[model samples]
Target: MDVLVVGDANPDLVLRGDVRPRFGQAEQLLTGADLVLGGSAAITAAGCARLGLDTLLLTALGDDVFGVITRQRLEERGVTLLLQPSGDVPTGLSVILTPPGDDRAILTLPGTIPALRPEDVTDAHLSAARHVHVASLYLQPRLAAGLAGVFARARALGVGTSLDTNWDPTEKWESITDILAYTDVFLPNANELRAVTGSTDVDRAAASLVATGTTVVMKNGAAGARAWWPGGECSAPGRPVDVVDTTGAGDSFNAGFLAGRLAGLPIPEAIGWAATAGSLSTRASGGTAAQATRAELA
Candidate 1:
């Protein structure tokens, strides 16, 4: 495998147009509703595969309809799976309420999202891959607790490691510093960077993380992306696109950036690839619906 992605795997129920709910036994009509593959790890893996990387995803999934759908979608996107069955719990699910704007709301039922543990990532898994990427850290408390050790092991095995924490539902961003010490790349959006570093300024937040020797790559929505390392920093402007949905765009960006790095591209060029991949993914509703292929990115 060229890349190994470890984290949550589930389906997303996306609803658009007039998605806000009203009380008092009232019902409203929606413009569209679609069930699609979700989870940050899954999306990132799918994106990497689409970008021509041999990708493997290690995640937990229940033997439920959602799990089956997730599996099928990932396979269709060319991502190999290393699934851990979620015992009696149903597969996780997220209901994304996308209004007629960029901002949206997500209500998640974390049935099996927290099932992955550190022990699940064995030595063989790290040795088989050139790079390892972890996602949705807050969703898996057990895995998060041991991620530092996992990354350390990957590093020891001569594998590069990256992390995308997604969002912290509890709003308490904890246990990140230890992991950064072992992480090669730290991927986070602007808001998440601020929340994690407790800094209102993006430069300060990125600097704080980069000080730990991990390269900090930040996603800034329409503003594109920026990267900061020990001795240098660079940025890429956002590509202009008619965005239909912003779901999973950042994950695609992560894939593009990693793909460029694995292919020996410089930071500035990798950031350009990241921005292009993220912009192209918004051409459709779900995260994987309009993900760019390697040729498209080229």
Candidate 2:
């Protein structure tokens, strides 16, 4: 399958601690840090590669050390890198603080990631893909602003479109309504959906999101996920995986779900596979640490 993943690219520096420090209070660090390729698109693309897909990643990275590492990692994963030249800015970096529990916080810098534009993605890139996944729409303005047009073009080229609605504090969620008109499948976690739609009712929110002409997969972490189409809905219960860090779980879920779809599995089965991938992702230090392969999912 030809899968295109576009959006943010960053290096994640994860520091594992047993307890979160109080304001100025120092805590003992249990595990040493590990640097890994992160960001929604990057993790998703890596997971896709692990699933044995022909994946292409379109993104922007700065000319710094972090950028170099990001590119090298992508190449090592066998993902085609369609990188745009970043002017003077540094590559994006996320300082991931993962406490002993499953929760974590990210201190991130967009750096050159916000510069990915429509011109960065060529007609060839769109036409060559059977499926295109647009990620972090709210975090990358240039790409995010032009997403609807991009999806429309991809559709004309007979490509299916999926969107991973990563969070943006300043996102105009209502504006995203228009983009869904061209999106075939919409993937969002529970919190992201709540923030975007300003509602807590999953059914109501899923219905509202699907009303905009997109199939909705409302991801409720740890509790499993829900998939809503026009005529029907399906849900898969979350598996009990030993939780470590909850960083890249959602992105991996997207990869597993897409992999299932490409393999011609039913939606319910796809969601089950997706949840398994997500749950397995939490067994290590960082987001991609415990990434599961297709064989593992099966």
Using lDDT as the measure, the top candidate is 1
Across 180-243, the per-residue lDDT of candidate 1 in tens digits comes to 8999999999989999898999899889878889899999888899999999999999889998
- How does candidate 1 score on lDDT? 0.93
Off by over 4 Å in 2: 18-30
Where does candidate 1 have its weakest 10-residue lDDT segment? 289-298
Q: Indicate the worst ten consecutive residues by lDDT in candidate 2.
A: 18-27
Clash statistics: count for each candidate: 0, 0
Report how far off residue 228 is in candidate 1 (Å). 0.5
TM-score of each: 0.98, 0.94
* Top TM-score model: 1
